[model samples]
Target: MKKFFSISFVLLLALSGILAGCGSDEAGGEAGKKIKIVAAHNQTSPDNPYQTGLLEFKEVAESKSNGDIEVEVHAGTIGTEESELVEKLKLGAADVVLVSPGFMTQTGIKEIDLLAMPYLFDNYEHWEKTVDGEVGEEMAKLINEKSNNDFKLIGYWSAGVRHYYGKKPLEKMEDMKGLTFRTQTSGVVADYWKKVGAIPTSIAWGELYQALQQNVVDSSENSYPYFVQQNHHKTDNGKYITETAHDYTTRFLLVNGKKFDSYSKEQQDIIIEAAEASVKAEREAVYAQEDEYKEKAIDDGAKVNEIDREPFIKLAEPLQEKAAKDMGAEDLLEKIRNLK
Candidate 1:
């Protein structure tokens, strides 16, 4: 009887130990699992610049982390409107996003608008130096501070130079007078157009095509690739492509601060490195497509003109000064101008 009781007690002890071991293993497994990060963008799959960056980030991050992190791109899957994406990031519904500077400026971080100021950058080299240098660092710091650490601007990706596309050829600023042009609903852009005597009509991008087709808006401005890819030239009958180069726009990739903070140091470093690589790849893709798209536009019977930029610059300088004052971004603008 004594031996039987002893054996039973030992059996119960062993079972309890086994159960505890299993529970611990399950907990550790759950803790050790790879993190899944979702990145959202305004462009649809396989068609947006965000697509290339998304792939690059995923490839680099997964490889560097050895499958400890997974990045899934929710391209155009989150929201089409830039403002909506920004709001989603703030609410923690989205982990990361790729959005335009114009949209970011509207969030009360107006210093970013300096990037959209007309002709602030002479070429890609100038733009890159400013973005990757001290000026960019300062701007990033300000953005993070302004957002109360809800959003962090990780890096910038270029959208190329913007130009005017109209139904009739515009040879000078005077020709743009009283012309109804579709503009982003940004005071900075609208005010700039107003200064040049163009009627700035606000329109959402998704509705722009139909609006142009039905003659609701007579003209618009965007990069060559955007103009071609969006088929803006097709709907705007008698398309006139002018080389106004009004703004060198850039898109920002933002990360939710809390989500970013949740990552380990190693994981954070991996994300940053991946973003840098993706930015480089994206810039190369953009440069290659710029001329290719311009050629396509010409082939499609769109008249392309290489206009004299001096006249446009003269008209824009005073407006630039005014914008800098209104947005309180003059110091950053000066720093950008000094970048090599």
Candidate 2:
């Protein structure tokens, strides 16, 4: 009887040890466990800058962690809309996501809308200086705090420079009068277009090709890589290209802050490094693709023209001031302007 009791106690101890080991693994113990990250972007094009950026992130993260951290990049796989991506990230369905300022504002981070203001940035050099500097840091902090750490801004990305394309070319600001423009129909972007005498209209990015082809909208605006890849310039309503040079665009690369905090310090470090690499790779891709796609559009018979931008700049200034004051980002606006 004594021998039997001793054996039973020993078995109980072993069972407890096994349960504890399982608990540790479940609690993010690095031993014998691999971390999986779901990184996503809305653009589905294989040659897209977003894809290049996220893949670079995957490579750096996996290689640096020696395969301990596995990054699975989904390009329009899990979510094709920025809104969907933002929702997934907040719900913990996605670990990392790329989103635009317009959608980010929809998530209750209104300060981000500042980045989407038309004519806010003069050129890519000015944009890089602002976002990689103090203004960017402030914005990131605001995002993390405003979202209660649900979002952590990991990096800033560009969607290249936006231009105007439509059925007809604009020789001056007055030419935009009475034109139905496809663009953000809300916020400062809409206000700017309206002030310039164009009627702002909202359309989904996916449906835009059909809209352009069918002449459902009279005109639209976007960067070269984006509209060109969609063959927008080939459409009857999209054949004319004017270098409006509005919106040196900005995209946010975000990770779930709560999830980031839960990771081991080493894992967090690897993620930051990966983000840095992605920013570099993505920007280079956009710059190169912009020139390539612009040339492609011209070769395909898309009319290309350049106009004096002083009129557009003049129109955007008052709106910028009013928007900055309303958002309580007057100081940030001043800083961005000073950079320019």
Candidate 3:
């Protein structure tokens, strides 16, 4: 009887130890569970390229991880302006954000602003070559260094080229004279518009339609897709399209340095792969839709004109020279110009 009791006690002790070990393992596994990421953008819907790319990222990240990671999109919910978005990204309030190169000027990478200079590229191919080549890599490196390890640029997505639209047909730069044109608050953009003899007026994108309806502004410039998507053509306040192609706007997919560092090496690789895939998909989509949007604008009563691009290009020469001398972007501009 004594032996039986001793043996039973020993067995109970072993069983308890096994159960305790299992509990610890379960707890550790739970603690090590999936990583969650939030991607923020100014896009309000999935229809836009920025939002679509982010959605693709979410799908690829989650699907590829087999449920080990999750990405939530905070489109147009975090902030309305680019500056605000950058601030949120730096403060770590946002894990990821889609920002324009224009905003990088504040970080001492003023050279990026020169990319927005009017009529910089002769065609989309030239634009792509410059961005995908050494110049783009250098700019990215400069941005990373200037950011002080707060943000990492994952990829660049197209915002397309901006063209002018107005109520009256503008056949030449002189036709833009005295027109109250809606302009971004960018000093370079404002100066460009001023030099072209138009009155540059600053208006938030959300308020543009109302501003147009009330005759607050007579004209604006943007990519054809944006103009079409925003229903600016329907306003009937403007019907002329100029082939100015002033800016080849681009947005960056940036990640929080701290949040990215927390992920395992395998997880980081997966996220970057997903981001690159989404960027390729987005570029294809934008190029496919570019002409479609232009046709749609014409069908909707907007008069499309293929003006002499050379004159506008010549007009922009002074601005480029001024930017080179005063803005310290001459080297970057020269690099882009030298690209074959």
Candidate 4:
């Protein structure tokens, strides 16, 4: 009887060890589960600054996660429109996205339109000060709250300073009259353009090259790197570039806030760090490419000219002030101007 009892006791100990091994494996698997992130931007060009910025994000995120995180970046693959990206982001289809203020405003976040106002920023210095300071923090908090945690602003990115490029150069304020300009169709930007006498027309970014080639639009405005890289200068309606310096454009690097909240504290810290790195890399790329592409445009026979921007700035200021008040952003507007 004693011998039988000893054998049963040994079996019981072995069973307990087996169960403990299974528990350890289950916990290990849960802790080491691989996470996948889908990062996307609207620009398709591999040489574009958007690509540069996102690539930096991917590198930083993956490296910091030690192979537990995988980032799949889609540059106009999943969607070419900012609206589409924003929609996907809200639905949790996209993990991270890049979008401009105008498109973001269409998602019912009109307060963001303040960033899209023409002549709102005088230069890159003013822009950096506004977006990297307390004003930016307030805007970010507003976005998070307004979005109900659907969107979280990771960083502010620049599309560089926008200038006017079209079939004809604007020598003066009157030169814009009657021009069918391809630009934002709504918000303060379109209002400012119309007030300056250019009839604003909506054109998709990918379609603008064809529109310019076919004379569907008489004029368009953008930064040098954007239009020049698309070979817009080669189009019949895109040869003349006037340095209006109208908008120092702002883009938002956003993550799905709910998904972000679901991540471990370590993962969230890594993502924020990655976003900071991306912001720096992207701005540097845009600054460098602006000079590079401007030279390229000139060398490629695009006529470049400078106009008296004071008139445009004068036309834009009242609109900016009124729009700021309408959106309850009067203080934010004052803050922006003070930064200048």
Best of the two (1, 2) by TM-score: 2
lDDT of 2 by residue, 118-222 (tens): 899977888887887778877887887799878988888889999999989999989999988999888888889999999998887888889989888999999
Model 3: which residue pairs collide? none
Candidate order by decreasing lDDT = 2, 4, 1, 3
For candidate 4, which ten residues in a row score worst on lDDT? Answer: 1-10
Q: How many residue pairs collide in each prediction?
A: 0, 0, 0, 0
Estimate, for each residue in 94-197, the C-alpha lDDT of model 1 and write its tens digit: 87788887888778888788787787887777777777666666767777778877887777788878899988878877888988988864567777788778
Residue 150's lDDT in candidate 2: 89
Q: Clashing residue pairs in candidate 4, if any?
A: none
Runs off by more than 4 Å, candidate 3: 1-33
Q: How much does each candidate deviate from the true structure in C-alpha RMSD?
A: 15.1, 13.2, 15.3, 14.7
- Model 1 residue 50 lDDT score: 66
Write down the RMSD of candidate 1 (Cα, Å): 15.1
> How well does candidate 3 score on lDDT at residue 201?
87
Note the Cα lDDT for every prediction shown. 0.75, 0.85, 0.72, 0.84
- Can you tell me which runs of candidate 2 are displaced by over 4 Å? 1-32
C-alpha positional error of residue 133 in candidate 1 after TM-score superposition, expressed in Å: 0.5
